[model samples]
Target: MVRRVVVVGIVLAVVLTPLMGWAQSKAVLPPIMPLRDIKPGMRGIGRTVIQGQKIEEFDIEIMGILQGGGDVIPVRHLILFRASGPVTDRSGGTAAGMSGSPLFINGKLIGALSAGYLWQPGKRELALGTPIEDMLTVLDLPNGTAQTPWPRTFAASEPFHIGRRAITRVVVTDTLAQAQRVDEAGLPGMTAFIPATFPVMVSGLSPRAMGFLRQALGAAQPLLQYDQEGATFVASPITGGSSVGILQVRGDVSYGGMCTVTLRVGDRLLICGHPWDQMGEVEYALTTSDIVTVVRTLQEPFKEGNLGDLIGKIDQDRGPAIRGVIGRMPRMLAVRVAVTDLDAGTRIEKGVQVVRRRDLAKTFAAAMALTAVDRARGQILGGGTASVKITLRAKGLPRVISRENVFYNSRDVALASLLDLPDALNFLLYNDLAPLDPVDMNIEISVTGKRQTAAIAETTVERREVAPGERLRVHMTLRPFQEQTVPSRVIEISIPRDFPRGPAVLVVGSAGRQVSLESAPEQGLAQLLQQEPQPSPAATLDGAIQLFEDYGKNTDILLQLIPFGLPPEGSEFVKFDVFAGEVVRTDWVVQGEIQIPILIR
Candidate 1:
C-alpha cells in the first residue's frame, strides 16, 4: 500500500510541473502601486531605517488615502494606518528623518514614506507615502527595469520587524493590494518626486579657469601643450619714432593656476588683450587651474569642449603649426597660433636666443661700451658706421661680449643684421630690476667722469678706414645743467697707427683734478677742470671757505672741443682761475671760477 501511494504522488507532481511553469511565465509583475490602500485598520509591512545602509522592511498598513491632484502629476498618498509595534526608537515614528523609506505591500513594491501633515494637536499624525509608480516615472524608469531584482535569499522579515518582532514574511501580493485600494479612492495633489540619486553633465568655461580646477583636483600630469614661436626681429624706428618689435612667447610647462610674468616690454603687450586677462603687472606666478593650449589652425582650436577637462600635459610638443594645448588627457588639444603683423621692414626666424628678464640694463651698458668704441673709430676714420654690441653680465655664465659686423652704410643694412646679438657682460650683476633695474656706476666716457644712476643704456661701435698715419679727433660738448653747474670734463686720446679699430678709452680722471699731459699716438692728454664752487652751509667763516675749496676740488668743469683731428702747428694751453667773495655771514660764503684755455698741437 505505501509503494502504491508513493507512485501516485510522483505521477501527480510530474503532471503539475508544466502547468506551474506556464503560470509563472504568464504572470506579469506590476512595477509600483499607490499608498492610499493602507487603511488605518489594515495590516501590512513597512520599511525600517538602517544607519549607513538601505532601509529594511517592517509590518505596517495604510490608515487613510489622501486624495488631491492639479496640473502636475498626481501623488497617490497613503498614511501608515498603524504599526505592529514601536516603529522606531528615540528617532520618533520612523522620526522626522525617516522620509524616503521604500514601503512594501504584501510581496510587491508600494511607495516611499514622505512626510506627515498634522490635522490637529495632541494626536500625532501618521506618515504619508508617495506611490512608487510616480517616483519611477519621474526617474524615467516607469517600466521598472532600470535595476536588477533584489536577492530572494535576503530576509525581508529583518526589515519589517516591530521592536524584536521579525515581521519579514510580508508578501508582495498584500502590499500591492493595499496600495491599489488607496489609489481607487483618489490620487494626491500633483507633486513630482525627486529621485534619491541621479547623474548630470555640464560644459562651457574659459581655458584658464578650467585648468585651475584640474590642478585643484590633484591631477598627476599636465593637461595642455604650449608651443613657442622663434624670436622676432624688429627694425629700429625709421620715421623719427621708436617702433616696438613683437614680443614672442616661449614654450613653457605650467600646472593649473595663475602664472606671473615680467615682460621685457610690458607696455607692448596689453594685459587685457589676447594672451592674458586684465590683471595688472605682477612678478610671482599667478593662480590658473584651467587647461590652456595653443591652437595652430582654426580647424583645431579646441581639444576638449571644457577647460576643466585638461590640466596636465600642457607642455607636450605638437606639430610645428600648433602653438598650445589646453585640456586633460585622451582629449585632443585645440591649436591656436596668432600671427601678429611685423613692422614694415622687419622679418623673423628661429635661432639660439635667450629671453632677458632682469639683466637688460647690464646688456644696455655693454652695448653702450661698444658704441663708444665705434664713435672713437668714426672720428679717426671721418665717417660713422652701423654696429651692434651685446654683453652678458649675468653670473654663473661665461662672459659674453659680441659685436655685430660693422655696416659701412646704414642704408645698405637690413634689420636682421642685428639679430642673435649676445647678452651684456654686466647684465647679471643686478639680482633684479629695481624701479626697473637701477645701475650705479662711476661712468667715464673718455675724459669725462660722472657719478650716475640710470635704468639701462645700450651702445654700439663701428669702424671705418682712415688714411695711414692720420689722426682721429672727436668733438664733444657737455649737455649744460639747468640747475647745477655741470660736473663735466674731457680729455684728448690718440690711437696708434696699428691699434685695432674697436672700443678704446682716451682719458679717465676725477672731478676738479687737473691732469697735466702730453701727446702720443696711443696716449692722449687728459684735461680735467674743476668747476666753480657754489655757496656752502658752514657754521664758521673759515669752515665755509674750507667747504667751498673742498667742493671746488670735488666738482668737475667740462671743456668743449671742436674739429677733432691731427694736431696743427700752433700753441695749445687751457687755464682756469678761482674767485672768492667776502663771507656774507659767519656760516655762508660765495665763490666762483672761470676757465680760459688755448689749444695747440
Candidate 2:
C-alpha cells in the first residue's frame, strides 16, 4: 500500500509542471496584436501624459502600412496613423516626448508612436509608428552594440533631404485643392518618416554652463532645456503611457531626456520605440517625469517636463526600443561641490549623482563644477579670480588625488578656473591600464571680484656659481595687480648631484611654462594628463598617480635647472637628460618668467 501511494504522487507532479510554466509566461506578457491582422481604417486609443502625471487617451486612426502588397514583405516597417483628440489638438501635433506612447485597438497592444512630420506647419495630424513585434526584438539584441550616433539638423529647403536622399514630402490639408497639390509633387504620401527628438530637461545651470556642456557633448540638437526648478528624489508610480526619463545627472542639478512608457510586464518596461543613444547594455538612471504643458510652434511641438524620483535603470539600448527593469538602480558617482563668493559673502553647497560611463564622465563632471560656481556667485563672468581645490577618490587607487590652483580671467572667470578639471578627470577614468570605479568627488571653489594676479618682476641669486648637490637661495620679486611696489621673497633650489661641470641655467617661471619646458617632444604634460597610455595592463596604478604628483599648480613658482647652451636643432625649447625641480605655492596666479645665468663647478 505504501509503495503504490508514492508512485501515484510522482505521476501527479509530472502532469502539472507544464501548466505551471505556461501560467507564469501569460502573466508576464500581454497578448500582442500582430501586424498582419491590423487593417487600414482601424481606430485605436493611444495613452500618454499631456499634463502632470495623469495618463490620457488620444484617438489614433490607422491610415496604412509602408510596405506595398508583395509576395515577401520588406523589413522596413512603419504604421502610418492620424492622431486626434484633446491632447493632440492642444499641442498642435504629436509632441516630442510621446515617442513611446502605446496604441491599443480593442484592448489589444498594437505598437508605439515613434515618428511624425515636422515640416507641417500647424496641427500635424499625421504621424508614423514602429510595430510592436519589431520592438520586442530589442530584448534579444546584443549588448554594447555601437557608438552613439551624433545628433544632426537639416537645412531649410524644399523636400528635406538626409544624406542626399530626400524623404517623402508629406503635408496635411483641409481643402480639396490643397490636397490635390500634394499629390502632384510626386510624393509617396505617408511612406517615409524620421525619428522624433526632445530636449533634455536641465535645472540649476547657468547659460554659460549649458553652452559649455552642449559644446562638450557635441550635441547637434538642443541638449538641455532649462525649465524645472530642480530634480525630485521621491519615487512616483510608473505605468504604461506615463512619462519617463533617461537620467544622466540628478540631485540639486538634473539632466535627462523624457519619453512615454510603452508597456510594463512585471518589473520590465519598454520605452522610446526608437533607440536611446544606441548605447547597448547601458546602466542609465530611469525616473518618472512630470509634464508641465505642450508648447505649439512651427518648428516642432514638445512637452515640457521635469525629472522625478529614481524608479529603475535602463539596461539595454537597441534599434527598436530601450528596455529597463524597475526597482534596480544603476551605479552612480557621488559628487559634492561647495562654492563661496568672497564679494557677496555667500556660500552654496550642492550634491549630485552622475551616471558613470567612460564617454560621459568627464563632460558631466566639468559641467557640475562650473554650475556650482555659477550658482554661488550672482554672476561668474567679467574680471575676477577663482581658487579651486579638487579631491577625487576611486577604486584601484591607493590614495585620493587632490589638486589646488588659482585662475584669473578678464572675462568668464569661472570657465578659466576649471580648465584643468576635464583633463584630470579624463586621465583618472580612461587610463589604458585597467578599469577603475569612481568612488566620490569633492570640489571647493572661492571667487572674488578683484583680480588676484602677480607677475615675476625680477630674480637674483647670492652666488653666480654653485657646485653640484648644493642648495642656493634665489631672491624673487612679484608685482601685484595695480600695486606700486611689493617686497621680495626667497626660494631655495637644490642642484642634483652628477651634474656636468659646465655652464648651467636657473629658470624661474609659472607652473604652466615649467611644464612646457620640462615635457618631452610630442608628449607634453597636457596630453599625458588628458589621455594616459600605459605600456601594458600589468602596469601599476602608482605609475599613473606619479604623474599627477609631479604636476605643478597654477599658483606655484616653479624653478628648473637646465644646461645654459642652446637646445638641439629643430627644437624650440630646451630639453635636459637629468632634471631637477622645486615648487612654491602662493595665493595669487603667478605669471611671467625670468632666466638667470649660472655655472656648475
Candidate 3:
C-alpha cells in the first residue's frame, strides 16, 4: 500500500507524492503537480541563478517523461523537458551547476533541472529532471545515520609535467555525468543526455598540486578553477532557486561543489537532483554561493560561482536529491602547514579546514603539505632534501603524536617528504583501540636544494666477539653522492648481560634496514622472498602512538644486534626483539645495509 505525501509549508501550497505510499497530512504547503497529471507540450518556467544571488527564470516545455524501465530512473521517475527564455538566450542553454533548479508548471512545482545534452541547438536545450515526488523522498530517510568514513590511501606517483597546466577557477559540477540515450517526443534521434556534473571550485593550488589531485581522484576528479581571491560575495539568506555549496575543503584551500536549491520547507531544503559524492547519510559542510556569471561555452555552459560562508551541513545524499538543514554547521578538522625554504630564507604558512571524514582530511593534508613546500620554494620539481616535522592532536589522546624525518629525492623532494604522513593519520583514524575525533594536524617542512644522501660503503668492527655487558665500537664508511667516501664514523653499541651465550647477527644500515632487521621473523628462503615486511599490529592506542614515534628518520644510521637463536616461547619466530640498538644521526640521508656475524661470550 502506497500513500501520497503532501508537504505543508507557508511560502507555497504543496501537494502530491505517490512513491512513499504513506498517509498525507492536511497542511498547506507549496503545490506540486503529480507526475500522472503532467503531459507533453505543457509549458512552464524554471528558476536558476545566472549572476549573483538573484534567482532568474527560464522558459521550459514538457517534452516527455522517462519512467521505470530501469534505464532512466530505476525506482522513481524523470521528467523530460526543453529549456529556453531570456536567461537561456543569454547563457546559450542549460549549464552545469544548475542541477537542482526548480521547475514549475501552471503555478505548481513539477521537478528540478538535472541532466542535459552536451551539444544542443540554438534557443532550446533539451534536459531531464527528477520529479518533485522523487525529490521529496529524501525527507523520509532515517535521520542520524551518518557513519564514520573509512580511511583512504593513495599510492604516491609522479605527476605528468610535460605541458602547461590550466589554472583552476570557480564552479561546482558532477564528477561523473551518467549518459542516457533518449528516444521520444520528436527529439533528434537517440540523443544522449548526461546528468549535469558538479565541478568542484578550487583555489590556491599550483599546477603540480592540481596534477596530484587528478592522479589521486582518478576518473572522479571534478573540474577545478584556480581563484587567487576566494569567495567574497555579500552574505545572502538561502531560498528556493538560490545557489549553494557543498564545501569539502575550505580556508587557505577552497574545494567544494555547487548546485541550485530546488525546494525549501521551513529550515529544510532539497538540492542537486543527483548525488554529489553518492555518499548517503553524510555530514558535509554546506555554504551559500554567489554566482559571478554563467560561463557560456560551445561545448558545455556552466555557472562560474564562488563559495560563500559556511552556513549549514548537508546530511543526506541520495539518488533523488541531496537534503540539508539551513543552520546546523558540520565538524571540520584543522590542518596547518608551514614550509621553510632554507636556501631562500623565506617561510610560508597555510591553514586549511577539511571535513571531519578521516579519508578526505588525511589525503588533503598530504597534498597541502606538498603545496606548502612548493609555494615556499617557488618550484615544483627539483633535487633536494627536506626535514619534515609533524604534530598530530586528537580529542581522546593523552598526548600529541609528534615525529620528524628527513627525506631526499632527485625529483619532487616536497612530495617525498610527505610520504609517511598519510600512514600516521591512517594509524590514528583506522585504529580499533580508539575513536580519534577532532583531529588536528600541523606539519612543518624545511627544504634545501641539495641532494643530501649517502650510501653505506663499508662497516668495520674492532672485534667480532664480545662478552656480555660489554660495549663495542662499530665504524661505518659512507659514500656521498658524486663525492669520495667519507671517513668512518664510530658508533657505540652495548651488549646486554644475559645467561644465553650464542652467535649473534650485527646489522648496520639505514633506519629502515635496521628496523626491518629487528622485526624480521625467522623464516625459510621461500617465506623471506615471498612475504613483504609489514608493521606489527598495535595492541593499544598507546602502542600505536609509540609505533608512530619509533619510526626512525631518513638521516639515521641504525645499529642493532639480533641473537641467532630459537623462537621465543608462545611465538612462531623471533620478531621485533633486539639484544642492543643504537642510532647514529647524520647530516645526509643514509642508505644500504651490512651484516656481520658475531660470537657473544
Top candidate, metric TM-score: 3
Candidate 2 lDDT over 288-343, as tens digits, reads: 55666676666556666555556678888765678877777888888888889999
Q: Is candidate 1 or candidate 3 better by TM-score?
A: 3
**Stronger candidate by TM-score (1 vs 2):** 2
| Each model's backbone clash number | 94, 0, 22
lDDT tens per residue, model 1, 344-383: 2222211111123223222222222222332333322222
> What value of lDDT does candidate 2 attain over all alpha carbons?
0.64
The parts of candidate 1 lying over 4 Å away from their true place are 1-40, 52-55, 71-80, 83-87, 117-125, 139-601
lDDT of 1: 0.24
RMSD of each: 33.1, 12.6, 12.1
> Per-residue error at 359 for model 3, in Å?
3.3
The digit string of per-residue lDDT tens for model 3 on 10-87 reads 011111111121122332348999998988789999888777777788899986765432333243556777888888
What value of lDDT does candidate 3 attain over all alpha carbons? 0.66
User: What is the lDDT, from 0 to 100, of the residue 134 in candidate 2?
Assistant: 80
